[model samples]
Target: MARVVTKPDTLNQLNQDFEQQVLTVPVFLNSVPKCGTHLIRNIFRMFVPVNQQYHDTFIQIPVLRQHVGAFNYLQPKLSWGHLLFSDESAMALRKAQHLVVVRDPYDWVLARARFFLSDNFQGNLEHLKSGQINLEEILNMMIFGIHEKVPSLSDIYTHNAAAWLGTGTKLVRFEELKHHVQNLESDDAEQYFRELLSVLQLREFPTDWRERVRVGSDREQSGTYRDNLTNTAFTLPDQLPEQQRKLVDYAAPGLRNLLGYCD
Candidate 1:
């Protein structure tokens, strides 16, 4: 664990006070890209309007404080981003009850591949605009840089899950949220949803909450990569490259074994 550099005067009281304040402060939801981030956001929208914030890198403390200070206070703020933990981000997390979502890295990679393939994806990167790249190429691009310009894929996904692994942060399983789909029409589903809300300390939802959630979710979005690759007669990788494998391990310790995705 790395030591968080803070002011000397507040060093002793910081951790204690941070833990106490987290429970009451707003929810800060963050996740690796294509990891059911929008699904969680949609669910939260039922209770409170989800505010969008895009801090793509490891932000410094003073700048992060200023960014957070500018958030709209008319409603409960839900600041989200695809950011990894750093001293600055850790400091920002202090003021909010943050939740991070993780998915099987294999699935996560596939989703990103599919996303970039879409013509609607407004990426300025050359690889993204071509639409001729394969899944393997996509993985290569993410791990190694694209033309040595954009940040590497590992730069983002490596230690991505680790960013939110510390104390006072909640981990939401993408699998659990997906399972909710099966029981969406049943009373047990409402109970499950309620349990989720309880975890976030949110208020009770309306009687028609399930319908609202369903309408908000894009059920067809999750497995697009599989469908696309199957149609093109492409095969999934037997194993990730050494660099990519390490990235996943760093982001999610023992993820394959934990998720039963290991060979």
Candidate 2:
């Protein structure tokens, strides 16, 4: 039997029933940088209907507020962003089903470094590209946020998971989701997606949509954090420059214990 490709319009028509689904408030998917923000966005794209307009980053959204007239009527909305939490953001999130994702900080930092080097990223790349700094110095700048007391691109890497998400946000580890989605061969794959759906209160995702999710795109280029350092000589401790190490120690206190990065 030939497989029929469903047109976007056809799929949108079929998904209209889900549009009217009851959600008491908007849905928010927020995360740490390099913590699978795109992964959740894909999930939302497949599961959420077209009529809904979800905000990816509340703060980044220009000139919008809690009582914005257009947003009030966009029922059952979903949003995702990489913004750090603040009192104002938290207050705005109170009315939404907010979720957060975190990864081992070491791994997050390493992946971010590679991503920073990519041509399309367009973030502050001069330091990473500079011939003067070794990988360790670059990692130090990223982890500690300063190289010689000047703020570096590594400033983005200083987020503490607990501090960023605060008290009310629900957290999921990046490894857990990556493991399940990337391993379709596993018998538990379906169960894992179901578990995610349940957690997010999204009851309408198409059952076979798992096969459509492009898990291949998620494969880590250098593999894990330690593997990312294979070409370089430094281990995790040696990765951070002396001053940067002190800054990291202060910035992410208890993060090592919290995220089980001890190994």
Q: Give lDDT tens digits, candidate 2, residues 1-263.
A: 21211112233343443433344357667677667766665555455655564543333233336433322424657666655555556566666666777776666656656555443344445455655767766665566555444343334433324665457667778788878777866769777777666644654655555644442223332132233323332224424345654555566666656654565
How does candidate 2 score on lDDT? 0.54
Per-residue error (Å), model 1, residue 199: 4.3
Candidate 1 Cα errors over 4 Å, as ranges:
1-24, 49-66, 70-75, 128-135, 143-154, 186-188, 203-207, 218-255, 258-263
The Cα RMSD in angstroms, rounded to one decimal, for candidate 2 relative to the true structure is 8.8
Error of 1 at 68 (Å): 1.2
1-263 per-residue lDDT for model 1 (tens digits): 21212112211222222211122235666787667876676555445432222333223333566566423333335556555777667665665667777776766665655555454343454355454776666766655556654555555554556545656767777777778855698777787788666644644445666765665454433233234222222344555666666765665466556434565
Summed backbone clashes in each candidate are 1, 2
Candidate 1, position 207, lDDT? 66
TM-score of each: 0.64, 0.67
lDDT of each: 0.55, 0.54
Question: Which pairs of residues collide in model 2?
Answer: 56-80, 142-154
TM-score of 1: 0.64
